[model samples]
Target: MSQGDERGYGDNDPGGRSDDAYSTLGGTRQTRTRMPRGTDDGEGYGRRPARNSRSLVMIVGVVVLLIAAIAFANQGGGDASGDAGEKKPDAAGAGPTAATGTKPVEGKNGTIASGFAHDQQGAQSAAANYAVALGSAEMFDKAKRDAILSATHDPAVVATLQTDMEKAYSAGFLKAVGLNEDGSTPTGLTFVSRTIPVGTKVTAEGVDSATVEVWCTGVVGMAGDGSTKPVTATWFTITEKLKWSGGDWKIESSSQAQGPTPVTGDNRASTADEIAGAVEGYGGFTYAR
Candidate 1:
């Protein structure tokens, strides 16, 4: 995996960075491998003499010694039991506890707006959650959509998005998904447009802004009888250029494209009733890194 350095600035909302636009959203491709069969090994290989048992033993002994030396060094300037020579039982075994407690402040980025810090992990988590929020069914409804846009987007972009989305979720689009003009349930059906993020990464980070990419999988369809389009999943990526604003992370600009998607599964499709029931039964999570 590629890694990069990240930094945070004091409470000041830096504007978006320049390299926000993506030339191509898709990632590099990897070559597929085939496993070797058991019979493919050289015929005479099994007859080779068992090699260097003594050398293996010596290597294991050295490794054990190295571990012991590290433990001893970690105990330095303190009791052998490791608590700065403290006699209390609870304090005697508290070295690891103290070390864990002293762990650095790894604040999350994007989440800082949601009360997270602007750290690498935080940035990734925020990207993932924001992707889910932006792709959710709520985005289809006027009120819920407005709430999400207001919460997650830069104030400047929300107005334009609101206008664009109003047209995008028009009556024709709703009808295509078996929903009413207003993006509501049609009688006995449950309209579902849920986005589940699979993974996230901080492609780049600046002092006051960051570029985050989220790989998301989602199901967008209606769950009801006579619906030709049953619940189906699609994979997509959302890349957001975020800036620190109003004590939180906000999307300065963002874009999305269809996946890095994998082939669809061959499992038997669930019944509409089953799908509706499952949707009602399950609850989604508030994700964090």
Candidate 2:
């Protein structure tokens, strides 16, 4: 979704009030309080207290440490012998951006895609594609959910994750999201729960294991004629710890954090009907690195 529109994760109010301020996927809000200004009654700086000797010493010590740290950093490990064999990342590729145009996985395991190369780039591609599958509406169905778990997660984590997901996507959650207990939307409505990865980064890596973080934007809600839960977007980052298993990268564990969100855009939001039409018209993709 474009900026300036309400960037959020919940249903919209038909009254045109943006309830979009609330995060739908269980997010916490933090508030910062500024220190109040001191009295300005023109006291004319009457009391000039002497600075504490301990505080001054502490400040000097901190400055010394800062200078030392900067000097050490500039030396890049302060070693005479450099690691000439190590590859340095370009400044451009070192930041958040799209894929490096690496080819996607070549195989599919059941409905889920597979056969990713056994490398850091493959780990990123697997994580991106797995994020899409795990965040899809199909995950609400038991059969599809099982298939997804089998395809993405390490065998050791699959059972535990299945139990956890069954609890997380309970009847109460389903109802709140405007889905039936069976995880189906109303006959005329379409349930939207799609994640689009904006970028991926390898956090930690080893010969056979890697941790990849996928920054994502997603939409979730029910779209229909009179639906209160109109589709709305959210921003989050999912970190997947992957293992090279049987010649393919598989997720060992995954966790999600709130966002690297931008300020909301000014675009006008569409109605429920329009949202439904758009969801039906546009199809999702299989993400790759």
Candidate 3:
């Protein structure tokens, strides 16, 4: 007999001979046979299980990779957060800059004042403004110079700095910047010796003292009519040793060095008239941390 007819019936075995053959092997006489529920011989049954397992594995792997990527992104791509993130104000004895709620006082001396926290920012601001005040044209004037010295310097250093500054701003130095021997304002020209602090930093801090470095750029020239070199800007760094005195930080000792400067710009220089007007119109800032 043919395999289909032998396994099931005489002629009309339409359910397929495979089902009949499976039933016959098990000694079943029934025309209909029950297939094994989880056999590998069915269409796509064997491959589909493995495929599903692989698909699940891939999905799990992708999820793990996404989690790892997000973690990496939060760490700023592994770059370190430096002094910027670490800065914090002092707890007790906080200064005006630290509180910000406290009003700022008119600086004790010239434009350079100090009521900053005894922390990094305060130390830096004090150093920078002190450098500006010390390097200013006002330091060449006798009365204003004395006032600045008295206000910002230690009592012991004031006298010494006064004498040293007098010699430093001598006749030859005045002549170089087109100023009179007594550091008077020249006719039709404004003497410029303004130091603008670029940034401030504290190298070291102690209970009674601190070491600060001030990065600064300054203009020192005679501006206006008949000026040879109208106004020239130069970059410098000032290192200050400061002491906490009666209610303020004062300069005990200080020194200066030139640049970290860059090459000159190609921009056209402003006319002496424009420069003078700009200088007069603009007011200086009361710098704080």
Best by TM-score: 2
What 10-residue stretch in candidate 3 is worst by lDDT?
21-30
Clashing pairs in 1: 108-117, 108-122, 109-117, 109-122, 111-116, 112-116, 113-248
Which model scores highest in lDDT?
A: 2
- Please provide, for model 2 over 89-190, each residue's C-alpha lDDT reduced to its tens digit, 9 standing for 90 to 100: 222434433435556556888766698878766766787788778667787676777788778877766775566456545676466556788777778888
Candidate 1 structure, TM-score to reference: 0.60
Q: What overall lDDT, based on C-alpha atoms, would model 3 receive against the true structure?
A: 0.48
| Candidate achieving higher lDDT, 1 or 2 | 2
Relative to the true structure, how large is the alpha-carbon lDDT of every model? 0.48, 0.54, 0.48
State the TM-score for model 2: 0.66
Q: How far in Å is the alpha carbon of 52 misplaced in model 2?
A: 52
lDDT of 3 by residue, 1-289 (tens): 0010111111112222221110111000101112235534222101111123332332222222222222222222121112223332233332232343434435555455766566455555566566656556676577887787777776766775566445544576555446787779888998766666665555556665666656555554557888664455555555566777876787765444445465665555666776677667555555555
Structural similarity to truth (TM-score) of each candidate: 0.60, 0.66, 0.61
